[model samples]
Target: MRIKYAIPIVFFVALVIIEKENNIISRVSDKLALKQTPQAPIHTSRSGNALPKRNVSVTSLGKPSSAFTLMKRHLEKYSEHQQAAAAVTNGRKDILLLATTRTGSSFVGEFFNQQGDNMFYLYEPLWHVEKMLTLETGGTNATATAKAYCDVLRQLFLCDFSLLERFIEPLPVDHITASLFRRESSSSLCREVVCSPFVKGVYERYRCRNMRCGPLNLTMASESCLLKEHRAIKVVRVRQLETLRPLAEDPRLDVKFIQLVRDPRAVLSSRMVAFPGKYKTWSNWFMNSDVLIDDNEVKKLKSNCDNIRMSVELGLRQPVWLHDRYMLVRYEDVARLPMKKASEIYKFTGIPFTPQVNDWILKSTQASKETRGIYSTQKNSAEQVEKWRFSLPFKAVQLVQKVCGSTLKLFGYKFVTSEEMLRDKSISLIEDFL
Candidate 1:
């Protein structure tokens, strides 16, 4: 069969497997003993229910898991050689593209991945850690959690996943996918790790739960971690800006931040449309309440808008030490002029706008009219940005606009009146004039 036709079929099959796997996991989680404790009223969508504990095992690899040991040795040897070469030139950079949900961060992260051999892009390694933290602590302990978060980030930059084992055991599929399968700098070390029994065991466990495993035979280059020029992590999990302060000030690493923001109205509108009746999982990310009092779509949108504003304000109020290391980018600007925006972002991170990066931008953003899911890697950037305007109800838009008025002004996104929403065909979320 042709590649185009086969792609959709494979995606459909994978989607089915993932959905089944989620159901199985939920069932298993419920069946497991809930680890009774003081039963303090913790936060969850299910009202008054405590966070259920799971069987979390922190693998104490005596000899190290075969894959882990091999990867570590390879990275160590490679780093020795790389450090010598890099000493003659500029060292590698560590960049973080930080954003809240529905802000086109996944799209932006792909820019680094497009660098192929030169960049090591980690797609939300901290997501699993966040999950573990919330489960264990009910999302308390801000300071300690922040320290641990930064610590894991530090280790990952140094190409170490063993430090992450305590937080996440048996390695989540997404982690394996990013580190091994889809990575650009997959060396012989990477291949050995991917094909090891450890990864296969995790894949088999996922398969038993009806989840699909990533490809086992994907080819990777020899430049695993030893020779990468840049490492960028795209994260949407951290709510407090203070959590990243330590990372920003680390004397050993050159870290830069790109804070991506979107108009709250557009963000909420997109969320409501894209995930109707299914946002309880991430609704309270920066919000106080879980389920909105009025279980309606408009109320959810309003709540989401409030959360966005709060999150943006928190990110903007960073300490003085982080001032020079940070740059803010708007989703609207990036969607409209992908290459230009990408170039500006590259310049901020000290990465050159290579021809390959530009080519990936064009292909990823301007692909043909195929139905893409919300979690799709490729995006029709311009359409995706402007979609909320026509898709959202006029009244809903008015509510989001009202809640986010100050923030909109802060980001230079003009107010969209109900009348304009009703009659204007060429309404833009962002103001053309500064």
Candidate 2:
């Protein structure tokens, strides 16, 4: 019985030793096989740009697996993918400066233009597109029209100005905006304002070096141009808020709206002085001079007033404003307190208030004795805030007051009668008009 037990024990011990040796040989053989195997080069995209190869742990089929290791590897890859997607998505921002002409939009546009490399600004890109779209749809098919506009706008946001080529072909450079089709045109005021390497390269690529229009550097994609963090446009041609509603609601686009307004009286004064009708005809008066506006001009004025009212009402209807995604800025207020208002604007838009912007504000707003042009680009505060108060005649003031009285009151501008105006120290009568 002892001999039989001893034989079984020896057999068991020998079997265990064989099993251990087999395991050790298997691991050594597996490692040698891995060492002898050649690694293939990672496949890369045709563009020649590729992400680095991930470090993957190698294992033999016979090796025991751990659920924890597998899960950790999977979680690491998932986190990397997520981070890449977020990096691509988080790089873009869209801002629309919604305002009418002669409402100090140019001045306000400068605020965005000064943001250095982070900003890509287009001044009035939609001015001609709005006209073309209006003619094509002709008040019918509102959905199609808005969609068409949005489509073009999307391209613009992506820095694909080539889409505007067809629209710009028939019209002369004077009638149609050249900047929409050709990047180096006067409308790319930022080329002058922001002369960074990126801006310079983009301008060289997108700009129609020749006056002729076609694909501008097809090799340079829209995505490349849109690599900047902020893309903004100051548009005056869009007639209704409805035209922009789709963009505001698009989940893919991170969009914000800024409504820039001026005192109606100021707007009227600026328009009249800039372009006045000599014969006192309605067309001439409405287009040319702000002095002695007749009944016909009043009708046009009322139309402008109605548009403003409708726009404001529409803005109020949108819940985005309540969520801090929308802002209303007055030209007077911005001119009066630039830094304070600029800080507010910067805070709202999530842009840093850079020293360059601060210096611009300080230098631009300094009162100068230099006689600047009526529509000079140089920032002049005294002229900007209340020029109409001094230059407009008593009769012209009264007419503007009557036409835009309700709008004035709504905007908190105190109405001053001709008598009340004459009493103020700043009032200078236009004797020729009187």
Candidate 3:
């Protein structure tokens, strides 16, 4: 009986040992399976929200997650903010008074030109570029001409006159030229400091005439530009705003654009009077009552209208590059309320409205009699805004409306269906545009 009991105990001990060994093997198998299986990647959701925490390590060479990309973009935007702040802190502000011809750019440009000694203004610096290109190649290569215009403008804004000298008529001799386009319009250019060794004290119109002042020394102009706190340029030759992207994006400069627009009908009327020689064909068409939409001159007008409309629309869309950097002002609005509009413009340009600007606006807009010079800025602006109605024939008005219908609508210019409506000054053609 004792031997049998001992045998059963031995069997029981064997069974217990075998069971323990099997349990250990199952645990080892489970660990091996866990090691071989691939784990899901640790990442944020597509919306950039973080995922629940897990015990996982990401490799250095792994793909960037959505959160990483978002953080990178944020860093880049912050860098842009820092750069813009640095620009503002440097006391350098560049203003581009952009407009088309016959859009009251000259008159409006005076807002900056008369801003005392702190402002350096350039009037139509692109004129030289356009004139030279037209003479050299009849401006057939539109791309080349556009590039040349932008290059010259970029240099001018940076106070470098070397590029501009190449285009000046009788090419600037030793950086001196008598024919800086519209030199009289820039107070900075006319000052005793820039004219040099000629006029004394403040610039007197008669005393500092090109004959008396001799040729403009571009070196002196550049020096004056560096001394000024701000630089402003008024240009009408820039047909497309997108062409200036390089200048606008330059990190070395802080640029702003104020685009001035006018009614297409008024612009056409003013162009006819200001450029009678060029518009003689249009005048003949008017006299003969034979205006055709397909005529080259009419086509040119349509192109101009389209260009202006496209630029204005682009600006209004507030592209990332143009954010807080573009403004649009109508000529009629500026004309009817010169002081208020000038204040608004000055505010937009980040400049102080001075007594000089105020006095000039008062004198310019309140003229007793209309100044008849083709390029004159002095006028009774209130009267001049609608003088086109008298000068432009009803037929011409109808033609402009048909060709520039979209532009007119976009710019808040009302169309006249009858000659009586064209002649009625009491009826306001300008609708309020926010």
Candidate 4:
């Protein structure tokens, strides 16, 4: 009886050792995953008394599973897959602007308040949804995720929102907006205001900012700022042409447009440092990012510019685009004499410039002059804006010149030195426009 029991006990001990070894093997395999963080390392150190440094910041904010990370690794791969057929468009009737990025869209939008009583300035309509998420969670992960989503939304909605009318409504009847766009009223506040095709995409992207859909409001909405109103005529600046195109195309709107452009070299040099790590960086939210173009990225961005150019150029030539009225502004010019440009913009849009509007433009322009685009004569306010000549590197400067030289030349920018001449074929591109 003693021999039989002893034999069984010896077998059980052997099994326990094997099971422990299997667990150790499993832990080893789980660590060092490419897409995921490894488990907490054992706390042993060479001195035995000290533990290793562990970066728990990631874990504290909810470290994704290694499997989730692996799945994310392949996310970019599926980006090329064909999209399902998009839905048809629902039309909107509002004044709109057709233009590109790095343009004075914000400033131009400010000009809209001067257009008249019905005018409403939907400032950074696309940015609200972004602010929504951050305002919701009030933490690092939420902020980071919100920003990334905002970038994705902006990039994905590259085309004018009007083009995808089926999937979206330009002036969606949300709680804050419902008052302006009641179904029973043919003369609703939404129609009264110059809603752009750009509004829908931007609003959709920023919708996250307002879960109560709180007025899709601004941080400064209650600052008691007066309207830069006109009795008649409505105009608004739109930065995204794809969004502007369809909205301006709608027959209900007596749309008037303005296309604003800036120097490409100035554009790139000005933005490189503002957002160091491309769209992923939080710093990019305010600074210009166009200056970091390489050969391929230049190709993509230039294609975007070209599409904008054609759209605006077509609108200028035809009465059908924006009800046949349009104007073009150079951001460089506006930076120098914002008051002058704003005055001229009011005239071109057929609105009487009110004292309030004039004062607003002057004050806003003056206050923001230092930090506005460095294309004008104002001295650099930051190291990032100043190093345009050096920061872009010679090759990147040439790439910008090669891709967007004509657009700059059209705005009367000249190459100042021999270095610029040898590489910039676009030096001659502007003479005809001049």
Candidate 5:
């Protein structure tokens, strides 16, 4: 398995999982930052459907069962750790809201953060871990390689530099950095980031005892990072379909996963503005040729709208995990009907739902394919979906329509007309399930 293909998407997506870690990439290139800025927000939506809620228990180690637990733990621990408690609850069903760039993830993740008892609305942990794994393994056997990568995480939690250097780009000097590095020093951030969990966790223990570091810094490093509030979920709310072959075997993270998708026309329409005039639009992304590239070529870009769509469709259809456990959600749906979306998530976790979460769902940015005017011809009763038809030029819309016709139809989106179009569009939904 030369992973020659999926590796790029995997490594790239790992960076997406923990966006903050890309502080490394951010430091290096503004171009990279442009694509990532959209992903900086936090959160997810739970579908609000009625169902039998499963049994849940908070662990003896004082673990949180819902998102709120993680939130309270951090806020109580430090005044500065304001928002972004993690989404996982300890000894409880892990709630993972698969978020894509700019699909109102911040509003959704934040909503859950406020609702759950044990959830920590922390920055995207998946992105951080993903990038770390990719850098370490180049997307080869991501599952086996990332398992080894977990030790590095444990080290950072403890702040043990003994082997932490191996995870760093150039490594760092320990005692020298501690003594010479001034407060808020560049070296300090480097040290803090590279340190093992044990080293940092214990050091945080010392800080809690002392009065150094601001309330925010202390809570973020110590309480949020060290406290036994919420346990990490076995979730990989990750993209990058091909590289996931290795990850598919990890029983913890392998259970069920979700992918966020949007119409390529809409994706390119916004992305055109997101990037500067230089190579900005789909034209720039696609080499600006009048001729359009087919699906096979799009998959090579990995991050491209068409590529991600194919990957998501294929991953769902051919999962290493079981069907009963696997799931999928649309980014547009998450933005449109958050409560309904959140309710679906609650079902996946097999947890109970509360009115409080339901009410929270009513509140959202209300930005989706519907409101944003991106549409599917399915008789789903369109509210405002169809952004591409309205926003993009006739040529751009036609280009996306021609190239992505098959993908759109596979997901149940209807083409304007023509038997060939519909046949090309239809996906193996039954094959995907049966």
Candidate 6:
């Protein structure tokens, strides 16, 4: 009996040693294979320009490798498989309503936001990144800030809120936070399933009065996102369209981009009213009748115009990836013919023109008077289009025309040669074509 027990014990010890040796060998082989693998070649556009590479660093957030990091890596590796699977499932459509501030983005965003129950719409999800990680706020440079914005957007698109939670003020506890920017703008977040124990129909009023709905449960938000057939995010923070090429190329997403542009002069005019604090200098210049062509504000305006023109030019080039996936819609066109333009936009996005959306368009575009709030979407859109001509000084208009000449021409906005031409509603400023 003793001899039998001794033989079994020795066999067990020997087996353990063998297993340990095999584990070590396997790890070594993996390392060798990894070392031998060549780096992926640089991706290039159809025009043979090298694409910008994202420097993905898990340590950038000062946390250990988390679910978001792992998911990003997994997606990168298995994107082809995921794309095939998505195709089989009839794929979730992702639309980016890309625009600049004070350019009627909020009103246009409602086109997707009010698209009934099947759509998950996020308004300015990048607001947190822009708010938190700016040079003045977080001591980070433009490149870092841009990376953070891109990372946050990518995670949001994947319905993974882990990365975004990091940027929220007063960090989330148990993935629950009330700090989500523009939470009320997202109807899905206000749904019964996500924010429970609330008055069903009076979410806005209830939320405003009592704050009874409590903080948003990001876990629930993610679950809600997964159930939606499509997702749309309206963003004003992303400056360069090329910066988003990777997102458009993402295999798990059927991404479509609608570049919503407005007349830069109108944009400047609107910005002056909407962000009076920031544009105080411009207001002072206008008030004092002192317009400097080479001022900092004027240079910034030129930079903005140049950026928009460049982005528009890139879309027009129609690289293989963006071919048929990109569109340019002027705010003026959409404003002039809401229903017709909405129909065209909906058709372009492959979403149905539901009765709910039609009703919303009819009601929203026919406001007897503009709402008090600067951000309010309700407006007499056709009348609102040329309202800038009255508010913006002729001198300011000429200055904008000078700085944004290329952009204005590219978007088919006619330069107002005089105050009369600018104010005359009958003299159409929008050309039929470029």
Instruction: Write out the backbone clash pairs for model 2.
Output: 272-290, 275-288, 276-288, 276-289, 277-288, 277-289
- TM-score of candidate 1 on Cα atoms, chains taken together: 0.65
What tens-digit string does per-residue lDDT give for candidate 4 at 1-434?
A: 99989999999999997786544433322221211233222233224453333222122123356987767645632532222111112221123444444454545555664444434443333333333333433422322432232232222122111111111233222112322211111111223122222333233322321122322211112111112221121222222344444334322233456666666675655455444466333223224455332455657658655655565556556555545466767665666667787788767766556776676665665444455453332222232222345444455555556676565455566543455653454443222241
Q: Pick by lDDT: which candidate is best?
A: 3
**Between prediction 2 and prediction 4, which has the larger lDDT?**
2
- Model 3 — which ten-residue stretch has the worst lDDT? 53-62
TM-scores, all models, native as reference: 0.65, 0.63, 0.77, 0.45, 0.47, 0.79
lDDT of 1 by residue, 1-434 (tens): 59989999999999997786545434323212132223211222223343332222112112236887678757765765665465336767888887877888888887886776677777676766666656755553444445556666765665545345445543333223322322322222233333423344333322211223333221121125435777787777665555666666544467887888887767776665567667543444324434343447556555545555665565567557676677788888898899988998888787788888789788888766683677665778888777767665565556667656677787888777666654475765577642
Model 5 Cα displacement at 429 (Å)? 18
Q: Write down the TM-score for model 3.
A: 0.77
In model 2, the runs with Cα more than 4 Å from the true position are 1-91, 131-148, 170-224, 277-295, 317-322, 367-371, 422-434
- Candidate 4: misplaced stretches above 4 Å? 1-94, 114-118, 126-249, 279-295, 319-323, 368-391, 416-434
Rank by lDDT, descending?
3, 6, 1, 2, 4, 5
Clashes of 6: 0
Residue-pair clash count for candidate 3: 0
Clashing pairs in 6: none
Give the winner by TM-score: 3 or 6.
6
Q: Higher-lDDT candidate among 4 and 6?
A: 6
Q: Say which prediction, candidate 1 or candidate 2, comes out ahead on TM-score.
A: 1
Model 4's TM-score against the true structure: 0.45
* 294-380 per-residue lDDT for model 2 (tens digits): 666678787787677577667756665235557777777787788888888878787787887788777777746574555544567
**Winner of 3 and 6 under lDDT:** 3
What are the lDDT scores of the predictions, listed in order? 0.60, 0.58, 0.77, 0.41, 0.40, 0.75
Off by over 4 Å in 1: 1-89, 138-144, 171-223, 279-320
